[model samples]
Target: MTDQAVADDGPGSTGGRLTTRETAERLGVKPETVYAYVSRGQLSSSRAPGGRGSTFDAAEVDALARRTGRREQPAPAGELTFRTGITLIGDDRYYFRGVDAVELAGRHTYEEVAEWLWTGELRPGVRFTAPHEALAAARRAVGALPSHCGSTDRLRVAVVAAAAADPLRFDLSREAVLGGARSLIPTMAAALPPAGGEAADSEDTSAGLARQLWPKLTARPADEASLAVLDTALALLIDHDLAASTLAARVAASARAHPYAVVSAGLGVLEGPLHGAASGPAHRMLTEVVERGGAAPVVADHLRAGRRVPGLGHRLYSGEDPRAAALFDLLAQVPQAAPALAAARDVVATTARHTPLHANVDLALAALSVATGMGAEAGETVFAISRTAGWIAHALEEYGERPLRMRPSGHYTGPRPPQPLPDATEAPSQ
Candidate 1:
């Protein structure tokens, strides 16, 4: 094992490395435990001169110590600890309220799964209908946006309009919040103008949320297999543990914002390319791959341009993403999805030859959009809508805690405070 040398003037330092005893002391663990961490690949150790003993990198040991919860160093501003019963991710799979998320998605519709997440109850055949006033207001606000506006923008505007129209939006009681969420989610969906002027159908109340969402995404008529994929995607995407958008939503909820505002906070963060918008690039990539009839040149082009090949790898899962696995299984049932799905597989296989990376949810979502003729932004829309339920669940949890508990203290690393103030009359130092 090799690492950049990091010299220190402290005790137990030698030749820019720490002996095993020093590493153990720094980690507040026994020397045997330090060796265990090294064996487990959590930490790495290098050989000392003449192979006398192992010498550990000071930086790596310190990082492992921090992760082990030693308080020798102050926690960074971004490190947050909280308690909740919403979701648990580990061992290449995730669970919601202790139920396997993949299994739950397979067994339940999006609405039912959302209901389960919110209240821990499975209500079969449940439907979320938008209130008349809220739906009308959202529609008006969404209609006012430019025709080329993306779905995330429309959803953001619709949320604000819905909040404004609700007389009881401020009610934070469990029943009231649940009622508001039921109405608000459907309102956001119903507000988007249908594709090709496809009229809103009775499915708004009579069908699943995916059924209502299908026409808005594409003019193509919905097929049973395709609709099933959409529904499962919505269900699978309901929540991941404190994702960036979820953290923003939790922060808003901790500040006592209403459900709509909490959702608005989440949507704002979701618009970033690293989050919900990640699939758009993947969609375009898959489209190019299909047009060129291969994935090699497209993947090479991305690498040559010094860009990451989208739709591959995830930080959380070392193997295939579970959500992607579930979606790919369902997409196989849709006959029209075969070509795009094949393209996605080819991309994954091509990239794996160099650095093996598994397909994530973004790639699967891209294939679905490309195959079904939806716009590039359709995955983000699906993400925003499905995750609204999760944000609400987090809000509900935050509402029960002390207000403003999510506030994180700043760790200033700027110039000393005693420095004299800059004089406006003098030119600023270059």
Candidate 2:
């Protein structure tokens, strides 16, 4: 076929065509692998009408690219490890900026803790008040979503809108970025649709970040103890070392993506089941225990079905997750939360009798959700909100480092090559 025919058959044409080098780069392989693909009949190529080389169908190359991309081996050992001065997880404990997270949770507001993480100083009287125009833009953005959408969905929309509205969102200097984050957290919380469509108590800007978020999570009146639980949960969750979402945010920031874009990247990663959504199942599990009046049957059913129990263990912690233990300890003191506390304890005891696994932070968040009558997905919402501090901190850290340093080199492991294609006269008909 002539070059004209190849063009006619390309992507915009009947089928797209790629040169040998383009095809190899698309597949992340050597040029030799392109020949092997042709020999194995995995890819079809046509001789250039007047030239000696071959051209491939762009669509076919794309299909093969997707297949081989999935089969690519995991990154080599130690390749995934990186250094960070953010949260540290070891010895079943978590620390943010060298201070015990549990200790910080007990005394500090989420805003204060977040400030410390971002700047290494626990500055008091930190306010996350959003500018009127930014808040208005974010509210309009959240209002555009469907009524049944969860808080995280609303948050994602609000972040995008806020980014577009802010003229200075691209300012990556530490002070400007930190100022943007400060405004973002409260705007996002205020922008969430008030639970049950009741207007939020806007009169109280003096309330803590958790207080601002409470009415959005549920319509129930805020109890001091319950608000305390949420406040502590927020502080505790402010950061963790290189979580999947944080890593994604850092990667985006490494490329000099703006603060809003960096956070949007993190929220996208957190939407996955294995990450932020893990608490939804854990909440359901605890609810079942409450309804069934015993933990044994629910525990047995989950085990018998070969399903991993949600919220039971952490890969990094050998004993209880310190965050979980601390949250649960506070929940124990809330008289109004006695039922949830009882159910959580029963589940813990029953699970421990059967397996070595102990409760993790997901379980604590779930228990908090159930205990407070928050929405089923409230745990993830709280997680996404609280972790924004960590994501921004990691983004700032990454911005100071070399750009695009997270790019990984791939090692190809495909079919051997050096095979010859059939001669033009002997080649099969199209």
For model 2, the superposed segments whose C-alpha errors exceed 4 Å read 1-76, 201-203, 413-430
For candidate 2, the per-residue lDDT at 205 reads 52
Q: Write the residue-wise lDDT of candidate 2 on 1-430 in tens digits.
A: 1112323223212235667766665576877989999999999988754564678886687678656652233457765755456787767887876678889889898999998888778788777887789889999988888877777788999999899889999889988999999989888888887776778455365567898899988878889888989999999988888889988998899899999999999999998989998989989988898999988898899999998888888889999898899899989988867777788888889988878888899999989998888767999999999999899999887776657767877777966687688567776879
Worst 10 residues of 2 by lDDT: 1-10
Clashing pairs in 1: none
Compose the digit string of candidate 1's lDDT tens values, residues 1-430. Answer: 1122333212344544787777776676777998899889998887776556678887677667656754333346667855566898988999987789999999899999999999889999999998888888998999899988899999999999999999898999999999999989988888888876757555445578999899888889899889999999999999999999999999999899999999999999999999999999999999999999999999999999999999999999999999999999999888899999999999999999989899999999999999999989999999999999999999998886667755656889999889998977977889
TM-scores, each model vs. reference = 0.80, 0.78
Q: Give the alpha-carbon lDDT of every model.
A: 0.88, 0.83
Candidate 2: clashing pairs of residues: 9-15, 10-15, 10-16, 11-16, 16-58
Which candidate's lDDT is highest? Answer: 1
